[model samples]
Target chain A: MELLKPELGLIIWTTIILLSLIFILTKFAWKPILKGLNDREKTIAEALNTAEKTKLEMAAMKSQHEALLNEARQERSLILKEAKDMKDAIIGEARDKAKSEGAKMIEEAKREIDNQKMAAIIEVKNAAGNLVLEVSEKILRRELNSKDEQVKYINTLIEQSKLN
Target chain B: MCEYLCATKKRVIALKVLKFKLFITIFLLSVFSVSLVSAAHGEEETNSTAPTEHNESKKEDGKFNAKKVILEHISDSHEWHFFSYPTGDGYKDVALPLPCILYNDVNGFSFFLFNKLHHGAIDGYSLNAEHHIGRSDGEGFYDLSITKNVFAMMISSILLIWLFRSAAKGYGARPNQAPTGLQNLMEVLVSFVRDEAAKPFLGKKTDKYLPYLLTVFFFIWINNMLGLLPGGANVTGNIAVTTTLALFTFILILTGSRKHYWMHILNPPGIPFGVKLILVPVEILGIITKPFALLIRLFANMTAGHLIVLSFLSMIFIFGQMSPIAGGGISIFSIAFSTFIYLLEMLVCALQAYIFTMLSSVFISEAIAGGHDHDEHAAEDLP
Candidate 1:
C-alpha cells in the first residue's frame, strides 16, 4: 500500500493525540484546574464585593458623622442664644424692679416727712394761740375796763397775727 | 435540304465547345482566390486552434500546484525563528536566541533543552538533526518538541498570573493604602477583564471563571502577539495550538453544564410538541456548533494572516527571479503592505484571544444557569 500523505498522517495522529489529550484533560486536568480557577475567581470577586461594601459603609459613616456634627453645632448655637436671652431677661427684670422699689421708698419717705412737718406746724400754732390768749388775759386784768385800752389791745393782737 | 441541315448541326456543336471552355475558366478563377481562403482559415482557426503560447508557457512552469507548494510552504514554516533578541553577549537579545535555536531542532520532549546546549554545531540544511529526546528526523516516534513559542507562552502566562496574584496580595486591610507599581497595572487588567469581558455575559457567575478566563485571555493574547513579530514563532497560528486550547474550552463547557443546559440543547422548554421536534435537533446541533465555530474562527484567522504575509513575501522572490529592477520595486511595496498587515494582525491576535476566553466564560455561565428549571422545561415538552 502506498504510504499515507504526510498531511493525512499528521491529521490522523493529531486527531488521536488531541482526542486522548482531551480525554485526559477532561478526566484529570480540566476539573481541578477550572475548580482552582473558579475558586480563585470566587475569592477575588468576594474581595471586590467586600471592597464595595467597605466603600459604601465608609460613605454611610461619613454622612452619619456629618449629621452628628451638624446637630451638635445647632445645639451649641441654641444654648448660646438661650443663655444670652436668659441673661437679658434677668437684667431687664432686675432693672425694672430696682426702679419701682426706689420710686416707692422715696414716696413713702416724703409722706413721713410731710406728716411730721404738719404735726410740728400744728403744735406751734396751738402754743402761739395759747400764749396770745394768756397775754391778752393778763393785759385785760391789769389795764382796767378802759374802752381805749381794749381797742389798743385788739389792734396789737391784729398786728401780731399779720406778722405771724 | 438534307445538306443544309448538316451544316447547321456542325455550327451548334462548335458553340457548345466554346461554352465548356468558359465553365473551366470560371472554376480556375475561383481556385486562385487568396482573400477567401485566408478569411476562411482565420475563422476556422479561431474556433479549433490549440497550443496558445501564453497558456503553454504557464503550463510548463506548473501553476496551481497544491501538493508541491504545500510541502514548500510547510518547509518555510521551519525557517521561522521562535524568539528574537539583540545580537551580543550580556544583552537582553541573548535570551531570545535561545528559544529560536531550540525551536528549529527535531521536535521531541527534551528538544528545546538539547538545542539550547548544542547551538554551536547546528546550521541551515540540517533541518533533520538528532534530537536529544531519543528521536531523530526519520524515527518520528515523538513530536513533543516544545517549540520556542510554546516556552515563551508558558513563561508569559506564569508571569501574568504571578503579577495578578502579587497584586491581590498587596491590598491591605486599611482603606487608605495605595497599590504599588505592577500591582496597580494588574488591578486595571483584573477590573477591565471582570467588568468588560466576563461580568456582562457571566453575571453572578462571572467570579467563578475570572481567574481561568483571565489566564486564557493573557495566554492567547501574548502568544498571538509574539506570532506577529518578525522571525517569531506563530504558536497561535498552529492549528494544533488553537485546537488544544479549544478542546480545553469544550471540556469546560461540557462539564460545567447544568441540567437545564442539556435540556435547552436536547429539548427546549415552552415549545409545542410539533415544534419541539424541529427545534430540539437544531438546539442540539447548536450546542456542538458553538465550540466548532470557536475552533475554526481562531484557526482560520491566524492561518489566513500568515498565508497572506507569506504570499506577499513570495511575490518579491518571484519578481526578483524575473528581473532585479522589477523585484526591487515590488519588494519595497510588498514590504510596506506586509508591515500594515502585521500591525493589523497584532490587534486581531489580542481580539481573537479575548473572544475565545469571553466565549468560554459565557459557556460556563450558561452551564451553571441550566439547573432544575431545564428539567422541568424538558419534562413539560414531553408528549
Candidate 2:
C-alpha cells in the first residue's frame, strides 16, 4: 500500500516538465528531422527515377542506332549489287559491239581481196590474146615467099581445117 | 564428392565426441567443488549460528535481517548509498545526503539537508523505517524534496534533452547533407519511432502525435538504462512514475476519442439487446484496465529485474556467514548469473520502451479512427 502511493509534487513537476518537453522538442527537433528525412528520400527517389529514365532512353537510342546501321548496310549492299550488275552488262555490251565490228571489218576485207583477184585475171587474159595474134602474122609473111610452098601450106591448112 | 562427404562426416563425429567429453569434465568439476564447499559450510554454520542464537536470546542487534537489507537497498532513499563496510564498533554507511523539502499547514515550510536527520528527529519530522518522512505526532506533510528517484529522473531528462538538442542542431547546420556522429545515431532512433511505431498506427496524423510518442519512448528508455548502472535510482520501477505516465496516456486516449468510439463501447455493434446489459460494464472496465495494465506491466518488469539481480548478489553474503570458502565458490556462479541477467535487462530496456510507445500509438489511433462507415462516406463526400 505504501509503495503504491503517488507523490503529488512529483506528478506536478513531471507533468510540467513533460508538457514543456513535448512542445520544445516538437518545434525544435522533430520538424527538421522529419523534413530532412523526407527531403532526402525524395531526392534519392528522383535520382533513381531519372537514372532509370536515362537508361531506357539510352536503350531506345541504341536499338535505333542498330536499326539505322542495318539500313545503311542494306543500302550499301544494294548499291554494290547494282554496280556489279551494271558492270557485267556494260562489259557484255562492249564485247558484243567489238565482235560485230571486227566481223564486219573482216567481211569487207574478204570482198576487196576477191575483187582485186578477178580484175588481175581479166588483164592477164587480154595480154595473152594480143601476143598470140602478133606471132601468127609474122609466120604467114615468111611463108608466102614461095607460091608452091604457099599452095602446099594452103592445102595443109584446108585439110587441117577439115579435120578440125 | 562421395569420398569427401564421408571424410567430413567422420571428422564431424570426432569433433562432437571431443566436445561432449570436455563438457562432462567441466560439469563434474563444478559439482565436486560445490559439494566440498557445502560440506565445509555445514560445520561453520553450526559454529556461527551458536553465537547468533546467544545474541538473539540476549539482544537482537547482532543478528542479520536479509529482508531489511534487500528492501532497503531496492527502495528509494533521501541519500545515495554507494557502499558500506564494517568499522571498529559498528558498520558505517557511505552515502551522500540529499535535500529534504516539506510543507505543512501547521509548520508552514521547512527545508534542510537529509544528513541532519541521520541521528534522530529534526524539526518534528523524522524518516521512518522505509525512509518516508513522518511527524513524531503522527501528522502529514507534502514532500517535495530531491529524493534519489527524482534526482535520477532529472538527470536522465537533462541528458535526453542535451542529446536530442545537439542532434537537432547538427541537422539545422546541414539540412540536406548526410548525418554524422550523434546525428546519425539519433536519426535512427527518431526514424524508428516514426516509421515502426507512429506511422503504422497514426497514419496521416502521425506528425501530430509523433512528439509525444518520441518523448515517452526516449524518456522511458533513458531512465531504464540509467537504472541498470550501479548506485543509480530505479526511476521507472517506482509506481508514482509509471502512474504519471499512464495518466498521460489515459488523458490522450480519452480526449482523442470520437463520439463513435464511445458508442461502440456503450452499445457494441451486432450484439443482441440482452447482451448489452452485461457487455456495457465489461467494455467500460476494459477501458480502465488498458492503462492499468500498462502501469503494472512496466513497474513489475523493471522492479522484478532489479530484485532478481539483487537476490543473486545477496546469496554471496548469505553464504559468507556460513563459511568463507563456500561464499567464494558460490560467488563465481552467482555473479556470473547476475551479469547475464544484467545484460538481458539492457535489451529489455529498449524493448519495453518500444512496446509502451507502440501500444500508446495504437490506442490513440483506435480512438481517433471513429467509425469505418463514416470514414468511407467522408472520403466519398470530399470534393
Candidate 3:
C-alpha cells in the first residue's frame, strides 16, 4: 500500500519543485541558450541571403560589363571608320587642288613667254629696215659717179630684189 | 589544433574515470548482493532444525525477500537508505534519514529529523512501521517532509540550473560564436529539442512554448539519468512528478487552444451527422487522454525499467535460496544481464524524455491548431 500510494507530501513537493524549476529554467537556462541558438540561426540565414544576393549581383555586374565592353568595341570601330573616311576625303581634296594650281601656273608662264617672243621680233625688224635704207642711198650716190657701174649695180639690185 | 588535442586528451581521461567509477559501482553492488545472501544463509542455518510451521513463518521475514527489497528500491521513502552492514551483534542501516515536517489541527507544526521518531513518538507524531509519518492520535496531518524523490528533484533542478547557466554564460561571453565544451553539448540537446520536438509541431508558436517544452525535456531526462546512479532515487518514475508535468501541459493546452480546435472537435464540417456524433465524443476524450497518456507512459516506462533491472539484480538471491553454488554461478549471469538492462535504461532515459516532449508538442499543436492549414491542405489533396 505504501509502495503504491502517492504521498500528498511528494505530490506537493513535486508540484512545487516542477513549477519552480520551470520558472527558474525559463528565466535563466532556456531563455539564453535558446536566444543564442536563434541568434546564431538568424545570422547564418542572413549571411546566406547576403551571399546569395551578392552572387546574383556579381553575375549581373559581369553581364553588364560584357555589354559595356561590346558597346565600346562597336563605338571604337565606328570612330575608326569615320576617321578613315575623313582622311580619304581630305587627301583627295588636297591632291585635286595641287593639280589645278600647278596647271594654272604653267599656263600663265607660257603666255608670258609668247608675248616676249613677239616683242623681240618687232624690235629686230625695225633695226633691219633702218640699216637697209642707209645701204641703198650709199649705193645710188656711188653709181652716179660711174654710169656703167650704176647700171650694173641697179640690175644686180633689181635681180637681188626679185630674188629676195 | 591545441584545442583538439586538449579535447581528445580530456575525453580519454573522462572515459578512464567513467570506467573506473562503473567498476567501483558494480563491485559495490556485487558486495551488497553477496552480503544479502550471506545474511539470508545465516538465517536459514539457524532455522534449519526448527519445525515446519516455525520455519515457514520466519521464511518471508528474514530469508532475503526480493519483492520487499525491490519494491522498497522503486518506491519513495523518508530516508535515503544506502546500504546496510551487519554489525558485531546486529545490522546497522547506513542511510540518511531525512527531516520530517508535520502539521495538524491540534499541533500546528512539528519539525524534527526522521530518526527522532524511530523508537516511539516525537511531539505526538510517529512514523509507522512503514516509516510513514502520522499523528499519535491517528488524526490527519500534512506530511510535508522532503522525501527521497524531492531531494533527488532538488539535486536535478540545481544541476540543470548550473548546466544551462554555464551555457548561457558562454553565450553571454561570446555571442554569435561557435559553441565549445559544455556549451556545445548543451546546444546539441537544446537544438535537438527545438528542432525535433518543438518546431516540427509548434511552428510559429515554437518560441512561445520552448521554455515549457525545454524544461519538461531536461527535467525528465536529467531525473532519469540521476535515477540510474547506484542507490539513486526514482524521481521520474513517481506518479506525482509525472502527474504534475502532465497537468502543466493540460493547463497550457486549455489556455492556448484556439477556436478551431473546439470547432473540429464539437462540430465537424462536411461529415455525416452520425459520424460527428461518434467523432465528437472521441475528440473530447482525446483531449484528456493526451496528457493522461503523457503521464502514464513516462511513469510506466521509467518504473518498469527500474523494476526489471532491480529484479534482474535480485535474481542471484532468489536462486541462492535453492543452492549456494547456484547463487554464485548465477550472480555472473545476473550482473551481465542487469548491466545490459542498465545500459538500455540509459537510452530509455533520453528516449522517454523525447517521447514525452514529442507527445506534448503533438497535443499542444493539436490544441492550438498550429498545423491546421497543413491538415486542411492534406485533406484537400487526399480528396
Q: Pick the candidate with the highest TM-score.
A: 3
How does residue A99 of candidate 2 score in lDDT? 98
- Index of the highest-lDDT prediction: 3
**Candidate 3 Cα errors over 4 Å, as ranges:** A1-4, A59-164, B1-36, B43-60, B270-278, B370-383
Q: Against the true structure, what is each candidate's TM-score?
A: 0.50, 0.71, 0.72
Better of 1 and 2 by lDDT: 2
lDDT of 1 by residue, B1-383 (tens): 88898888988888888887765654443333222333323433442334221121211232323333322332213122332222112102122323332223344223333334334333221222212222234344423333454454545555555554455545532223454676567656656777778888776566456656765676677767766766555556556666656666777788778776887777777789999989888888877777877777887788678777777665654554445445555665666677688888888997898788888887777776746664564465455
Q: Is candidate 1 or candidate 2 better by DockQ?
A: 2
DockQ, every prediction: 0.01, 0.35, 0.49
lDDT per residue for candidate 3 within B58-137, as digits (tens), equals 24355667777788888887889897654433445778888787778887888888877766688788755444677668
Predicted model with the maximum DockQ: 3
Model 3 Cα lDDT, one tens digit per residue, A46-134: 99999999999999999999999999999999999999999999999998999898898888888888888888888777756754674
Specify the poorest-scoring 10-residue window by lDDT in model 3 chain B.
B51-60
User: Compared with the true structure, what per-residue lDDT tens digits does model 1 show for residues A43-85?
Assistant: 7788899999999999999999999999999999999999999
Clashes of each: 3, 0, 0
**Docking category of candidate 3:** medium
Give the runs in model 2 whose Cα sits over 4 Å from its true position: A67-164, B1-60, B119-123, B129-131, B173-178, B374-383
Off by over 4 Å in 1: A1-164, B1-140, B172-180, B269-283, B371-383
